[model samples]
Target: MNIQLRFFASVREKLGMSEQKAVLPPDIKTVGDVRLWLISRGDVWAEVLAPGRALRMACNQQMCEPDTLISEGAEIAFFPPVTGG
Candidate 1:
């Protein structure tokens, strides 16, 4: 499936990217799957999207979990957790 990916805040800075359009493999089905696939690229991808890291995700502009099924042409976003003083 083809999907649009967005990175925000610190995540964007770390990845040196703000947006990307990807044609994912068939085995990649959900948000988490996408992340893991990206991580397979190694280096920065693995570091930034590491499984133990604190990150936030969204699908089609709405906050979502890892298992959220992704559809063709869907938009997925990732960012560091937000906090306020």
Candidate 2:
């Protein structure tokens, strides 16, 4: 399946990328699966998307849980948790 990926805040800086158009493998079915597949790329991807990371996710611009199902051409975003002073 094909999907668009967006990175924000520290996640973008850490990954040195802001956006991507990805063609994912069939095994990647949910948002969490996407994260795990990205982590498999190693390096910064693994560190930023690893389990236990304080990250937030969105699907098609709506905040969603990791298990959220994804479809072809969906947009997925990952970012650090927001905070205000």
Candidate 3:
């Protein structure tokens, strides 16, 4: 499936892009799957998306969890968790 990915804050700086379109493999069905897939690319990918990272996700502009199922044209966002005082 083809999905749109948006990276924000530090994540965006690390990846060097704000957004991208990805054609995911059939085995990747959810946001978590996408994260793992990217990590598989090694180096920066593995570090940015490392296991247990406190990252936040959004699907189609709405906040979502990693288990959220994504479809063609769906927009997925990743960033560090936000905090408020």
Candidate 4:
């Protein structure tokens, strides 16, 4: 499926892009799969998306879990967890 990807904060700086269009393989059926797939790209992707990293994700602008199913052209975002004082 084709999806829109958005990066935020440090992730954007590292990836050198705030947004892009991606075509995911059939094996990437959910948000988590996409994460792993991106990480497999190596280098910055591996570091920023490695397992155990404290990352946040959203689908179509609404926060979503890793298990969430993604649809064609859906917007998916990745960012560091938010904190407030």
Give the true-structure RMSD of model 3: 1.0
lDDT of 2 by residue, 1-85 (tens): 9999999999999999999999999889999999999999999899999998999999999999999999999999999999999
Candidate 3 pairs with clashing backbones:
none
- For residues 1-85, write the lDDT of model 3, one tens digit per residue: 9899899999999999999989999999888899899889998889888978889989999998889998888998989998899
Which of candidates 2 and 3 is the stronger one according to TM-score? 2
The alpha-carbon lDDT assigned to residue 78 of candidate 2 equals 98
Global lDDT of each candidate: 0.96, 0.97, 0.90, 0.94
TM-score per candidate: 0.97, 0.97, 0.93, 0.95
- Candidate 4 residue lDDT tens string, 50-70: 989999999999999999999
Off by over 4 Å in 4: none
Q: Cα deviation in Å at residue 75, candidate 2?
A: 0.4
State the TM-score for model 3. 0.93
Between prediction 1 and prediction 2, the one with superior lDDT is: 2
lDDT of 4: 0.94
Off by over 4 Å in 3: none
